[model samples]
Each structure stands twice: as structure tokens, then as C-alpha cells.
Target: MYKYLFFLTASAVPGAALAQDSTEDALAEILAAQDATGPAEQPADNGGEQITIADQLVPSITVTANGLGTDIRNTGQAVTVIDREELVSIQGADPTRALQRVPGVSFSRNGPAGAFTGVNLRGAGSEQVLVLIDGVPVADPSSPAGGFDFGSLLTGTVSKIDVLRGSNSTIWGSDAIGGVIDISTRADTGMQGSLELGSRGTAFASALAGVSEDDFYVGLTGSWYETDGFSSAASGTEEDGFSQIAVGVTAFYDIADSLELSGHLNMSEGLLDIDGFPAPNFTLADTAETQKTLRYWGDIGLTYYGADLTLRARYSRADTDRSNRADTGTLSFESKGQMERADLRGEYRLVGGLSAAFGYDYQRNQYETSFDSFAQANIQGAYVQLGWVLGKLAVHAGGRIDDHDFFGSETSFGGDVSYGLKDDWRLRASFGEGFKAPSLFQLFSDYGNRDLQPELSTSFDLGIEKGQRGTGTHFALSGFRRDSEDLIDFVFCTGLLPSPCSPGQFGTYDNTERARAQGIEAEAGIDVVGTLRISGVYSFVDAEDRMTGLELARRPRHFGTLFADWEAGFGLSLGADLRIVGDSFNDAGNFTQIDGYELLDLRAAMPFGDNLEVFGRVENVFDIEYETVSGYGTAGRGVFAGVRAQM
Candidate 1:
């Protein structure tokens, strides 16, 4: 019978090739670069007819993330999803280059008034990563260093962005250490809308209508953005930066039939212009830093389920008022912050494919920064999670315990496992532990250092996967290792009219008995024909510092990205992208290094008659000159054209 069950399941799986070569070789390079009768596909806007995100593994219902109204493939971890039609087919001007299309995600630009953009996950760093909205915690609790500026947020009513890489610190606790990114809001179904205008002095627009019969639902959004000044010379022509505005609204209802309710509100304003660079004194010139940012957010939620109980509760609010170099009378600064959160979670399924969840969360972080001191801090926490499943095997565990009257208590935990070995083959494993507590501007910020602590982690992973269904193809291969302990370093602060102690003075943000990292990751998704779609990802990181072995400042050892799309039924559509970057070193006074680049992008989509649609794009399409940091040279050979309408 099937060769004795395929040789008794290959002799009871021994070593299973120790995670490497499961054959398929990136699915034979997308079925040998398939063709098999192309064109006839166009479904992608989240609910592409039958749905996608690669079918979310089958199963439904998810509530405000991790509060677990359950069923998102029973939540076993190792998740990656990006919808909203792949987020406007990214060509960047914002939203962190649309998250660099995942896979070892990386981004950094240090300047341009949007002030710093560094989001790294997998290869960690960026304050060990941890960002969530719609589920609370939007980073920056007087953040003196813990990443999460998220490229000045506000993607104008975003839709989806859930990239949970690793070390989840149990169920998301303590900055999750190097993982947890959930940016949600956008489920208007229909009555959707969008508008546009562009190029350096750009004019942009956004809108999504709303209406839902019975069990009420509401939606509304507003956006506007502007940009000017880029004459390259490394963007220094007496530099300039400005323009931005945002407004948002969301609502959901369903009082019974398994009760449901939701709420959200947003506001944003921006005006920035920082043209820095040209320091190291040559009679100082090339300066400009005048910025403003005002933001506000709110949320509320409740959910309940049946067939073994499930529940959730949430409340959140955020406020930010920021100012910098206030027209530079010499040097001036201002920062204001406020965050409030109340979380209550629960889950239960105790039988068969087991499940469990625990709750209780509260946070209050206050801020007041102005360089020479005016700080704040106050944090609180609690968390719990447990899950398991049989039939295709699955398991997950979580924990979060935190306290910070001022950089004190901390706790984190995580676990995961998966197996399906058939119906397309699958196998996975995980181990996680993370922590980071010490902020108030690094314990008193503004050159604060009251003897800091808390920064620990341990991680491990393994993977394998194969695709199924109507052929096409799907693939995954992985490897990772992370080790860190008290490894939070930043020393060398001296002051004497700005000499900040010259020798790691107030620079006491210590913690580094050891630090390490290792990696290898790959991804592939394809459908290749009759609708055409292809995806790719690659990452290789060494990440360093076992005591200044270096490679840790702005880390980068290798990266990758390749994309393709073609939708046709006659209306026509085509898209392409290629990005590869490697080589990096900057930190530890290496004298600067940031070179190793390649970029290409293209797009074409037409439909101008049924609900209007038009497209044109060519970004860096061989713009070849690059630098993501170090003299910051990014943006060359740019062009954009747009039109998208839906009725």
C-alpha cells in the first residue's frame, strides 16, 4: 500500500537532512520560469475572490491580534503577511520603503527630517524591535534607544503589515526583543477609494468610504503628503523638507451572535525640513533642522466566541507633540509624549487540539525631552499564553512580565513547534526568550545613564516547507541563531560645553557580557502563469560583537528581494522589482562604510475603461548610485505616474 507508507515514513524521520535541501530548489526556479498559457488573473485587494495571503492556511476568524478570537490557522507562529494589494506595489516615498518587502527586513536613512528610519527584524536591532497598533504599544516611551520611529509612521490609513520574525518574548512582552510588528486598520470591504499626485513637490490623497447594514460598520480616512528638495550632491543644496497631514476614523459593530464591537480614531500633522550633513567642521555649513509632528490615536475592543470559549478586551490611546531646532536660533528642541493602555485577554479550548491564554496588561509612559534634561517613565505589565494542537501537530507558549517604575523588573518567554510533513510537506521548530528594560532615554536620557540594565535574548529556529494545490509553487527554507545577554551597549559620553565627558561619560547604557547572532533565510512564492505572480526573499547575516568583533553598527552582511507580477484578461498589467544589497560596516570607528548596492524597478498596469486604472513607474531603474547610510545618497533616476479608481 503506497510502498508500505513510503518506507514507513522514510524510516521514522532521522535527522531529516538536518534542515537543508528538501529538494525543490526554490521550486525548480518557479517551475522553470513558467509560462504554460499566461494571463487571466487579477484578484488581490485582500479578499481576492476566495481570499489570499496564500490562503491563510485555511480557517478563519481573527480578532484584534493575539487577543485570540482564534482561527488564523490556529495560531502556531511563524507568520508573514502583507495585503492591501501588496501595499500599493511599493515604489517608496514613505512607510519605510513599504517594509523592504520583508525577508530579513532592513531599512535605514538617518536623515531627511523624517528623522531616522531603521527597522530590522531577523537580523534584529532597532531596540530589539516591537511595534503594534490596533493592538497597542506604538514604541517610544521616551525612547532613548529602542527603535520604533517606524519611519515617522502614518501610512495614510494603512491596511496590513504583520511581520513577526522571532524572539517573541512569549506572548509579546518587553519589546518582544526582536520581533512583533502588527500595523492594522482597514476592513472597509467596499465603498473604497483613492486619489493621487506626485514628484518631489508631490500632492497625494487617500480615502475609503464606509457603510455596513445590520451590525453596523463605519470607515473614513484622509491624507495628504508633500516633498521638495533633492538636487543630490548627497542632497545638499541648502536642503529642504516639508509637507504632511492625516486624519482617520474606523468603527465596527455586532452586539450579539457572539458579540463584537470595535473603535478607532486618528490624527496627524507634519512639517519637517532637515538638511543636515557637512559636519566635522569646515566652518560649519549644510545645516537645517526644523521639524514638527503632532499625533493622536485611540482604540477599543471586545470579542467573545463559542465551542470552547474565547474572549478579549482592549483600550488604548497615544499622543505625541514634537519639535526640533525650532528654526535654529542656535540649537533648540522640544518633545512631548503620552501613552495609555489597558489590556485584558483570554482564550480556552482545553480539549482535543488544546489551547490557553491569559491576560492583564497596563502601561503608562510619559515623556518630556529637551536635550539637557526633562525626562519621564512609568511602565507596567502582565501576560500569559498556551496552545497546542494535534493532527498536523502544533504548539505555542507565551509569557510576559514587566515592571519599570524606572528600568526595573522584566520577563519574556516563547516557544513554537509545527509539523505537517504531508499534503505539501512542512516542519518547523522554535525557541525564544527576549527582554529589554532601560529607557527613559536610556535611564534618564538626554545623555542619561543611571546604571542601566535589561537586554537579554536567546533564540533558535529551523524550517522547511513545500507548496500544494493547483501547482504554481511555494517554498521556504530557514535557519537562525541569536544569543545576547545584558548586551545593550552605548558608551562614550562627555560634556564640558558639549564634550559630554569625552570617555563614555554619561554614556553608561551598559549590558554586554556577550552578544551573538547567525542567520540564513529564504522564501519563495509563485503562481507563475495565467495571472502571473512571483515573489522572493533572501538573507544572510552574521551580526556581531562578542566584545567589539564589530559588524554591529547598522548591521548588514547580505540581503535580497525580487518580485514580479502580471495580470491580464486583456486589460493588461505587469510589474517587476529587483533589489540586492550587501556589504556594511559603520560603528566602532571603522571610519565609515556603506556601499554595496543594486536596484531596479518597473511597473505597468492598464484598464482605463472599467472603474479607471492607469500606471507608470521607473524608480532607480538602474539608478545604480547608492548609499543607505554614510554621506546618505539615496534617490536617483526617479519617476512615477498614477491613477486608480474603483466604483
Candidate 2:
């Protein structure tokens, strides 16, 4: 299945290898300059001299939430940034665990570790949220929903994660109905390694090595994890195990003072046990089944930075392969998917306090399954954005046009306004449009609908924020609404007298649903003492089908989180957090209701020296019995400890 991509990569390797000598020379020079500058400085502790809350805020150089590299505080969109320090403090094994605390975001997992997990943002399904790694889309085309599996993504090498809420189809072509999650890998010039052991017979290890200089940089990271996890079936006592290995590499070289070339490669492989059903009516059996997945992506790009303008051109390719095997070790299902993309973007400072950005992107997607032959599609998109700042007011607007091989064309537009008030207060509002074309499987498979229209959505939000820069206090309140149209679903044709299905066919896909979601989101944080801090977030969502007036499945109407952290002297810190999920229906008809639950987590860390630290955490402190998915078992109380070293 990967023959084409393998050959393409092989053909390009020689060229990259031929340039290795020059690259090494550049790297050596950069390393020397870095050494001369001395080692990087450690971040300042909050216990030291008091700093303004503004100074303590995350940096403003994010490029994902907005096309322009603007400060998040200045943008009129709801955004969350999780840096490396936060990840370490949370002690989460994967990205999904860390993201659960974010407002307006919820996850439904089938079972324990390595289970199939789905993320729902702002009441939108997993397929409506876009996932990116270093600005490259990573959805699996072979999957029914064409979404990325968050359970497979570990956080060992991640340096930053950005969550941009609401529709962003103007900037991202498709699958941006709910939001976007962009992940950035580490690029620090140092070495870091960690080893961990925990309950459920789990073991994990990771290593990172990187170096940076004045004009060149290179980094590599690798991690391995394995666990004898609990059974996935609700009534099963047999254990289900999982294992995974991942590696990533990144490099950059400056060909000239203003021109630079960069490349990144990421690969992961995993095997997981899944539960199978013996009968149809919601009964989960202990039948053994396993799945193996292999995923990889690589990107190479060149950028030219000038005093008034920046231009970049890049190409990327991603591929995924999956095989499902029965207890007898016979393959039952297999699928392969691949994506290739090329983008050319430019940002220009049109005038004082004003900027413009324009870009063109081309993509090709291909997928194949054991039951069907290969299928492919091509898409081309162009977008333009304008940003203007006048005094304390900022305005941004953008539009995009996408032409798909099968769907014809789609146009999306968005605009935002933000105004600063007195004393660090701000008012903001934004509106955006989103659209998602039918996936390849939905269009060409046996149960496909080639005449289906794209899913469409319009979203709006308004908010106000206040911050006390001097006292480490912050508060934000926001309200959002979204209307989705032409949602696709599979229906049994036998029910209809004049059935559209063939004689033996059971069902076919159709655009037969509409939905609306509205909610309020609130967040607050304050420092009560010198080194103690408390924070909380609450969300209320009313997500339902417009026609049936029934609540959406798996989306809780109310959810919230509260956390406290204390940094005592002697390089020791302790933290605790509580997550609350309200009751939700497990089925579309509002039957089979799932009860609400709350979980408490505790963590502690101690630093032995400047470069080494020991950390431990306890999840589900009360050993509560719960299930995120119907008829599935969840993990009980578990303890984990790990040691980390960096230089």
C-alpha cells in the first residue's frame, strides 16, 4: 500500500544526502556560536520577584489560531495554549488527556488505555474538528469519519499545543467546523530523557536530542510505551494489552541570511486489542480482536523573510495503514490511506499597523480497503486575509475558495473585531462559515452516496475578558452558537417501501440531519498567595437536532473543571484537579442515558538538581466506576511515577 510513497521518499533521499556535507558545515558553525552564547537559561520561578500577569502570559507568537502571527489576547477567537511546562505539570501520557480540561471540548473513549477515543468540540462531531501537526493536516481518509485518532498521539516530544475554537474554514480548507488542534514538536537545543512505570503492568521511555545555532538546527525524538491494560468489554475479566513506538526528526538550515530551508518527519506504529460483539442488541462479548496501525508524515519547506514581507513554500505527505485480526490471527479488515499537499503562502505588511496574507494550497487524497478498490480525489484552495490595527482596536477578515474534483466548489468567509477597554479589559466578536466534503469512503464505497452535498455550518461568538496584570487574576466569559445543515447519516433502505437500496443492500449514506448548538463558556484564575494558584472553567451547551429536537449523543449539557497548584520551597510542587462531566444520552433517540461522573487527580514533582526531576501522579483517586462509552470498562485508580533529566 505504501509502495508509491516509499518510492517517492527514496527518490528524494539522494538529493538530501548530497547536501549533507554542506548542512553539517553549517550546523558546526551554528553549534560553535551557540556554545559561545552559553547554555540556555531556566525559566524564572513564580516565588521570585513578583511579575505582572501580562508578563506571565504565554508568548504571542502563535500562527495557528490566526493566519498572521498575532498575539492570542488580541484575537477575537477563543483559544487555548498548552506549553511544555503545563504538559509536565499535568503528567498526562497523551494529548487527549491534557485536552480534556479545555472548555467546550469533550472526549468519549471506548475503554482504557489505547482505546479508540473521539473528541467533540463545541458539540460538533470528531469529523468536524481538524487536527494538524506542524501545519500539516493528518486525518485518516480510510476511516468512516475521516478524523485523526487522538489515542495514538503521545505527548513525550510535544512542545506546544494550540486549540482554536469555532469555525475556521477561511484559513483551513475543510473539517474546521468546530475548531482546530495544532501540535508543535520540540526544537530546543538540549538533551532530555525520561523513564516511567505504572499500574496495569505499564512501562514507558522517551529520549530527545537537539541542537540549535545561529543559522542551523537539528533535533530527534523517540518514545516507546507498552501496557497490559484492563478488558475493553464491560463484562470481561480478560486483560487487553497495547504497545506503541514513535519517532520524530526535524532540521533547519539557512541557505542565505534571509532564506532558510526546514524539514520534519514523524512516524508511529502501534497494536491494540479491541472488544467484539457476539450479538447485535448492545451486548459486548469477550471475543478477542486486535488492530495494528502504522502512520507517518514528512514535510519540507523553504521560507524567505524580509523586512516587510515573508514568503513560504512547502510540500508534505502523510500515509496510514491499518489491519484488524481476529483471535485466530486471521486478518478480518485492512485499509490504507495517503495524502499529499503543497502550499504557497505569503504575508506582506501593506502599511503601518496593517498586514495582508494570501495563500494557495493543493492536496491529493487516496484510500483503499479490502472490500473496495483504490479511490482518489484532488482539491485546490486559495485564501486571502487582511488584518488592521487602529489604536486599541483590531480587525481581521478572510475568505477562501476550494475546488474539489467531485464536489465542485465551496466558498467560506470569516471576520472578527476586538476592542480594548480601560484597565486591561477587552470586548470581542467573531463569525465564520465552515464546510466539509464527503469522505472518499462515503462517496465511493458500497454504502456510499455520490450525490450527497457537503456539510455546512455557520458559527458566531462574543466575549469579554478582564485581567489584572499586577495581581495574577484573569476572567473571561463567552457565548457561542452554531447551526449545521445537511448532516450525513446512514439509513436502512428496507424501511422505505420504494427502497433506494439494491435487493440485498441493507443501508446507504444520505444527508438527512440538521443540528444547532449554543453555549456559554466561563473561565477564571487567581493567585491566592505567593506560590499558590487556583483556576476553574465551566461550560454549558445546548446541542440538539433541529428536526427531532433531541439532544446530541455523547455530549454533556454541562461540564467543568477545577484545579489548584502549590509551589513550595525546595523545588517541590504539588497539584490537584477535578473533572466533572454531566449526564448525557448514549444514543441518538435519547434512550440509554449515561450517568454523570467526576474524577480527581493528584500530582507531585521534586527536582533533585537543575537538570533532573522526579514526578508522580495518581489518576481516579477514588477508584470510581464509570464509562465514557456504553458497555465499556474504564480504568480504576492507577499510580504512575517517572524520572526526567535534561541538559
Best by lDDT: 2
Give the Cα-based TM-score of candidate 1 against the true structure: 0.30
Misplaced by over 4 Å in model 1 are 1-90, 93-97, 100-145, 152-163, 166-174, 177-198, 201-323, 334-413, 427-433, 445-471, 474-531, 534-564, 567-573, 576-602, 605-647
- Models 1 onward score TM values of 0.30, 0.90
Q: What is the C-alpha RMSD of each candidate to the true structure, in Å?
A: 23.5, 8.3
lDDT tens readout by residue for model 2, 68-173: 5555555788887777788889985666667876789888877767777788889998888887766556787788768666766677767667787898889888
RMSD of 1: 23.5
Error of 1 at 67 (Å): 28
Assess each prediction's global lDDT (C-alpha) against the native. 0.59, 0.74
Error of 2 at 212 (Å): 1.8
